[model samples]
Target: MNTPDVAGATGYIDTNFKGKAEKAIQELNDGCDFVYIHFEAPDECGHRRETQNKIRSIELIDELVLPVVIEGLEKFVDYKIMILPDHPTPIKTATHASDAVPYVIYHKNAEIVSGIDSIDEESAKSTNNYVNFGPDIMKKFLGA
Candidate 1:
C-alpha cells in the first residue's frame, strides 16, 4: 500500500516498503491465502542514466534489502518462499536485457526434487515446462 519512489529521499531500495509488506503480511496472517510485494527499485536502478548509481543501487538491494526481506518473510510465513526475477538487468548495459534471471524457491513442507533449488541456467531450463503461472500453477497444485 505504501509504495515509495525508489529514487526519492527514502531510497526505493529502503526497508520502508519491506516494512509495509511485513505489516501487510501480518495483517493478512489470519485469512489471506497469498501475498505479493513487487519492488521495482532494482529495475529502476538498472535503467539509471548514470552507471555508478545503478551499481550502487544493485549493491544496496543485494546487501541491505534482500537479506532483510528474506529473513523477515521466513520469520513471518510458515511455508514456502520463492524468489524469482521476471528478467535480468545487466550492469554494464545499465538496462534490462532480454535474459532469463535467476530463480530460487524454498519449500518448507516438500523436498525440492527439481525446479529452482539452485541458480543455474541448466536447472531453469530443466524445470521450465513444469512451472507455469496462475491457473496452471493452481492446476498443478490440485492435481487437476
Candidate 2:
C-alpha cells in the first residue's frame, strides 16, 4: 500500500529499495505481525536489459536493505523472513521467463539443516524442493 513513484535514474535505490525497507521496518516497529517488502528495481532493470543496473539493484538490496531489516527484526524474540522473486526476468530477453524463481525461508529460532548457503536459482533447484503450484507457496510459507 506504500507504493512510491520510482521512475528515474536513482529511483531504484532511493525509492524502490531503501524507502521500502524503511517503511517495512517502521511497520514492524509499529507491531505488525506480517510485513511484505517488495523491490521492483531488479525486475525493472531486467526488463530494460540493463545488466549492470540489475546487479547493482541486487547488491543494494543486500548491502543497504537486508542488514537494516535484520537489525529491526532483532528487536523481536521470534520472526520469519521469506525472500523471493515472483518470476524471472532475463536481461538477455528483456522479458519474463517461465522458469521457477528462487525462495528462502529463514526462521529465527529454528535450526535449519539445509546446506544451501546461497539463494539463487541453481542452489534452490539443487535442493529439489519446489512447490509445483505457485500459489501454494503462500500456504506453505504461512505454515497453514
Candidate 3:
C-alpha cells in the first residue's frame, strides 16, 4: 500500500480539524506554494440539534488548529492567512445562509499589536481586515 503524502485523511471515519492541520503542514513540506485546510465539524454541528457542538468546533479550530497551522507555516516563510466561511450557518435555523459572511485576513507583515489578540467577526471588522472579493481573493492574494 502506498502511504499518502498528504495528511488529515482517513477512510470510513469522521474528518477532524487536526488532520486538516497536519495535511497543511505536510503540503508545505511537499513544496506546495499554497495550502488549503477545510473543517466540516462546524457545519456538521450546525446541522445537528446541539448548539454547543458548533461553538466547540469553532473554538477548536481557533484554539487548536489555527496555532498548529500557524506554527508550522512559521517554519518556512511568512504567510498571509485568510480564514473565512463559505456562508453563514445560523444555528437557530440549522441551515445554510446565503448572506455575506465576515472573513479575516492576516498579512504576515502587517502589525498585529493594536489590541488585536484574535481574529473573528468583530476583530476582523475593527481591524479592517476583511476579504469580500469572493473568488478573486485568492488570485489577488497570489498577485495573479
Candidate 4:
C-alpha cells in the first residue's frame, strides 16, 4: 500500500509503520506483554485535505499493516490487541474532535472476551482498567 505525500512529516505512514513494526517485533520477542501500534496515515490524510485519501489509508492499514502486526502477535502465547483512535480528526475540519470513538480489543484467547462485538463506551469506562483520555493515556498504553 502506498501513502500519498504527507507534507510537514519526515516519512509517510507505510514507511514509518515498517520501521515501527520491526522495533515492536523485537520488543515483543524480548517478552513485553503489551504492544501498541498507531497507524498515522488516516490522520495524515485528514490534514492533507482529502476524504478519499483518508479512506484509502484506513484500507491500506487493514490490508498491509494489520496482517504484519498479527503475524508478530502470534509469537506470543497469549495476547490482547486493542485498536482505537486516540481521537477523531474530521477531514472537513482538519482538526481533532473531542469525541469517543469505538475501540476494539482482540484477544488471541477469544474466550476472554465475547467473540462478537460487545465492547462499547460504557463497558470500557466501567472495566477494571478505565483510562481517562489525556496525555497520560499513552503512559497507560505503554505500561510505563
TM-score of each: 0.56, 0.88, 0.74, 0.65
- Can you write out model 4's per-residue Cα lDDT over 1-144, one digit (the tens) per residue? 222332233334444555566556667787665555666777877877779878887776677667778888887787767677777788888988786665665556663543444455566555555455566555653442
What is the TM-score of candidate 2? 0.88
Q: After superposition, how far is residue 110 of candidate 1 from its true place, in Å?
A: 0.4
Query: After superposition, which runs of candidate 1 have C-alpha atoms over 4 Å from their true positions?
Result: 1-11, 15-17, 49-78, 113-144
Which candidate number has the best lDDT? 2
RMSD, one per candidate, in order? 5.2, 2.8, 4.2, 6.6
Clashes by residue pair, model 3? 8-19
Candidate lDDT (C-alpha), each: 0.55, 0.81, 0.68, 0.64
User: Candidates ranked by lDDT, best first?
Assistant: 2, 3, 4, 1
- In the range 1-144, model 2's lDDT, one tens digit per residue, is 444343333545344566677777888787677888777788889999999989988998998789888888898998888899889999999999989989988888884879988899999999999898999988877872
Pick by TM-score: which candidate is best? 2
**Least accurate 10 contiguous residues by lDDT in model 1:** 2-11
Better of 1 and 2 by TM-score: 2
Q: Model 4, stretches more than 4 Å misplaced?
A: 1-14, 110-144
